[model samples]
Target: MTRMLERAPNLAILYPRALVKRGGGHELPDTRLGLRDVAVERERLTEYHRVCGFGPSDTLPGTYPQVLAFPLAIALMSERAFPFPLPGIVHIGNTITQRRPIAATERLTFEVRTGNLRPHRRGRQFDVVTEARVGDEPVWDSTATYLRRGAGTGAAAPEPGEVLPTTAVWRVPGNVGRRYARASGDRNPIHLHPLTAKLFGFPRAIAHGMWMKARCLAAIEGRLPEAWTAEVRFAKPLLLPSTVDFGVRGRDFSVASGGRPHLTGRAVPAPGNATPHPG
Candidate 1:
């Protein structure tokens, strides 16, 4: 595993050069739509609906982004031509903006890209920006930071800021990890393969980040009002067979697993003119 991490290429190599070089600048591809023909048997929205501790008919779980985003991320990351090593990298953080509510039946395309790559003060660490679009409409954008084990400058931590508004909390069950993997077709060994996770230094398979996100949305529901935008930062990985507490307080919502915070962020109700909730 260490050898694999050492050989991992920089994320810059993963950019679709042909696409980026076209028109003299980085250009995102046309939206690529995906059909919802696949039946959702295991990790169906119904399961999350119940776990969210919300009543029936509430908006679809926010983590719905995983249904498309995770697959898209995987597809791009797995492209042989892409530079980064799939097994060597860790997903350090994620930020999502929901331009519109996602419906169970809506056909959606994903527009993905490896954005800016900047070196962190820590020698081997770097941050990569990624974005996803639904059709011509931009749906979500996120920036993820990665630490290249050998490359850090070893600088002191930055100072802290005033406390942000708090989010509500909901409890996540231990068994959902397997459930999400079964439903999302994201049976990535790191998430479901115990041996694989141990090799990667995790005690056990972890819950999909999207699953945790979905739980956050369910926690806030009517508390956030319609059309609101929420942005979450993953602070830690949620290990398998663990329960999480999630909720929105003031403008913030959080998910904590094994007594450690996994994700935290603020949400704003969507503007009146924004897209309405889809059934």
Candidate 2:
């Protein structure tokens, strides 16, 4: 674990250059990267919310803090202790939770760590955890799970959630993926142009799963609490510039297209001040 390092949110995209991979032993140990004092940037937050379709509110969007802290997370992943390459890892799922609605003006301290490598039917999997707090009081956290495809451990993947009957359809533009790429700074060639997508085995550009999660949250924002946990399992890759159906029943929700599910998720209440918030 490294000592706390402070930085501005805008530089998060390139902070990893300072870290060189020092591959770790088998455990994939838990190392505290550093502490970051995040001063919420309202302008960027509003832009992010706009791109993801969240209606503007004085309170920060539940997922915005995670984005602000991502640079630090990237720096942590760049450490010599990390085992995988920065590219090519597949994000299989994610979980985000918070004690209450975080105001735009609230101060935050971000703590990041990674661990829990395990076997999966497709390959190996691990988690990246990010936590934010006000002084000593915790407010929000996220766990982003990634899968490295290779040598299967024979551990079966988790069962998929039952698909919910859809209530609405969204006609996504062909350029939606590129548009999101600009806003999210995830310019993965696979999510931008068609030619680049085909290089990665995708027939066309695919929408970002995080974008899908944010869009889903925007649709059901009223029902989500400042104190809520959202767990999302990524399914079929969403073909860009296509229409997708959405359905929400209770804590269960899903996004699908061509009668196939793209993602299935559950949103539930979370207690305030919990530590090591699971993703």
Candidate 3:
């Protein structure tokens, strides 16, 4: 069942709620959290565009709705019923499908839920799915796979063998996390500062996985079809203050630094017959 919110939940409050629920249950929640008729926050969107290297456009970035729906996603995961703690949950993969280009002015309804609990070589994994609708027509949706490290299962996750050929390079600054957090409202400490990150086992602060995805889409923005799906696997954490190479072959892409792959993904446009109406 869906529970509608009067407004976006304050992340300031939700983060603490998640921390407090650290030792919660092992079952995923069935409740779907939602919000209706929410307009795009133009200022935040602009800041996001700046940080992610996206060009200005009348339409929303394919990943924008994910950030907009993120608070709801957290609300679902922070509940006492959620299995794992939010602090160390690593985002392992993400997939975003846009039925069509959504205009910036469009008001959207969003719903978020969690499920797909499963085992991994290093831990347990689950999905947080978010869907957005313009009126009653579904415009966009995304699934973010997160993992909580603990035990072993089948084989270890596959690794990207050799680095893809480079097409461009990016110099990611240390403060990108703070900039993105301000714009996207995902202030996970691991992405915030080296001190905070060390508390999570990282030598230095890392970049947001979604930020990497957005930057790649921005690099190839003109080539993306109006209706397409983008999927990516986060191979390794992108340490901040790094220089990374981006490679693309056909629809496939990867981001790497010093031949170590950080992310790999593909973008595939929907077939003409499968494209949805923009309105």
Q: Pick the candidate with the highest lDDT.
A: 3
Better of 1 and 2 by TM-score: 2
lDDT of 1 by residue, 1-279 (tens): 001111222223433232233122223222232322222333366665664344555334455544544545544444444444455555555555555555554434444445444344443333344443444555444455544343656564232122333343334455566676655556656676567778778888777776666666666666765455666666667776655565456767666644556777677865433553252
Candidate 1, backbone clash total: 25
lDDT per residue (tens digit) for residues 1-279 in model 2: 556885643433443343234445556656776565567666667777887889988777777777777777676666667777655578889899978777787778888888788999988899999888877777889999988787888898875576789888888788877777666656667778899889778999998888888888888898975589999999888887888899999878899877788889999988854333221
- Assess candidate 1 and give its lDDT: 0.51
Query: TM-score of model 3 relative to the true fold?
Result: 0.94
Off-target runs (Cα >4 Å) in candidate 3 are: 155-162, 271-279
Q: lDDT of model 1 at residue 25? A: 23
Q: What tens-digit string does per-residue lDDT give for candidate 3 at 24-124? A: 67778798999998888889999999999999977899999999999998888887777887877889899999988888888899999988888888888
TM-score of each: 0.67, 0.87, 0.94
Give lDDT: candidate 3, residue 208. Answer: 96
Q: Candidate 1 vs candidate 2: which has greater lDDT?
A: 2
